[model samples]
Target: MTGPPNSPTLLREMSERIRALGELPQTSEARAEVEAALGSKWWGLRVLAIAVIGAWRDKAWLVERALRAENGMAGGRFGHARTQSWRDLEAQTAAKAAVPMLDPADAGWLLDRWFSDEPLAFAFYEYVGLRLDPTAVERRVAEEFARRRSQQRRLPLFRLLRLRRGVADRDARLRRLAQGGDETALLARDLLSMEARFRDRQAQTPGGAKRAKVSAGAARRAAAAEALAESRRRAGRKGRR
Candidate 1:
């Protein structure tokens, strides 16, 4: 929703002031001025102000002040809490925060919640986090490996594909589905193989594996079955409804 970093005139003034300070600005007055500029009507000004401050990590005062300013904003408060619902933003913020003062152990937990058992997101974070701390990142990745083994203890796929095939190889849902019988395992394995193939193809290119595949046909069929089942259950729900 916000515009470019330097979009606002007030933000430009803030930048000029920050540039004048050269290093991180030390004075409480200067920090307050930056905060005031950031509090402008345009959200972009706030982003710029925070960004400028965060860029100077050596300035603990500036970073803390910027964080305080961010916490004061509506978006920072409500938006951050909403991270629990929106995995993308949650993962991004967690990954960014992990790079700063947060410990690698903490980063592992943050990455876990952020990825929400999504293999692709987990893999992406693993790669990025590696750049920050290789040993720690790899250890975090081992969690996913453990998850895969745990999932394998469940069901076996047959209908769509074997449990060993397709998208089932990577999807966390496949592990859950495996708890059922042959049919569940089969469908899960098929979906997993499909996802794996798609991801593999993408990984052969520039961006590596960032995209996730969802099957429209499969989703529609599954939704229809659920709807029919719900309709049948409606008979029992008549008085309750």
Candidate 2:
């Protein structure tokens, strides 16, 4: 059946229902209500229902359903028909639902897909990275980074991926590229400046100062560990030679 007509009243009712569900624990009745909402003619209400269901349930099937709905509604060539806000909502809901169900292999596969389809939605890759265990996803991450580095012109998305990988400061090649005037360089500079500002502010506060010191120490340890690992890798390569 069709939902209530498009009007402020309809939106308000949907919003109220969502807010009410947010306050209560999930139940069979709540799931039924969400399912009913999904049948609504109003796209907004349908999106809301999908998001609520995905967040409330641990079922991987539900998450996949949400992902399919989002892709059909707001992705690909026909995606231009939807409002930007609607598209954003679809991406957010699908990402939230898909992340937990993703495995390291799935993450790698998705990353490969993203590289093949450069213009694909950012939320897909962003959410996968967010949920990824860095160590587990290390191989794919390194492969993607290497591929991006080989390209002559650095894309904004490439810079974003590097930022997400937390290697903006550690990767000397990327740091060198940041000196050149380009979109990636601008973004890299902005991120570095923001980090500097955060550190400065932390130093000004008593508790923050202590936390900052601890953070610095942790960073040094992490750097040392990384260096040691790289040394071992180099030694292994030499022995193989």
Which candidate number maximizes TM-score? 2
TM-score of 2: 0.48
Residues 83-186 of candidate 2 have per-residue lDDT tens digits of 54565565567566666666655655565554553333456666544555545444544455455642322232343334344443334434554676754465
Worst 10 residues of 2 by lDDT: 150-159
| Candidate 1 Cα lDDT to native | 0.43
TM-score list, all predictions = 0.38, 0.48
lDDT tens readout by residue for model 1, 123-152: 334444343353443354444444554333
Clashes of 2: 0
Error of 1 at 173 (Å): 16
The C-alpha lDDT values of all candidates are 0.43, 0.56
Count clashes in each candidate, considering only residues at least 3 apart in sequence or on different chains: 12, 0
RMSD of 2: 12.0
The residue ranges of model 1 lying beyond 4 angstroms of the native Cα positions read 1-11, 58-103, 117-192, 196-241
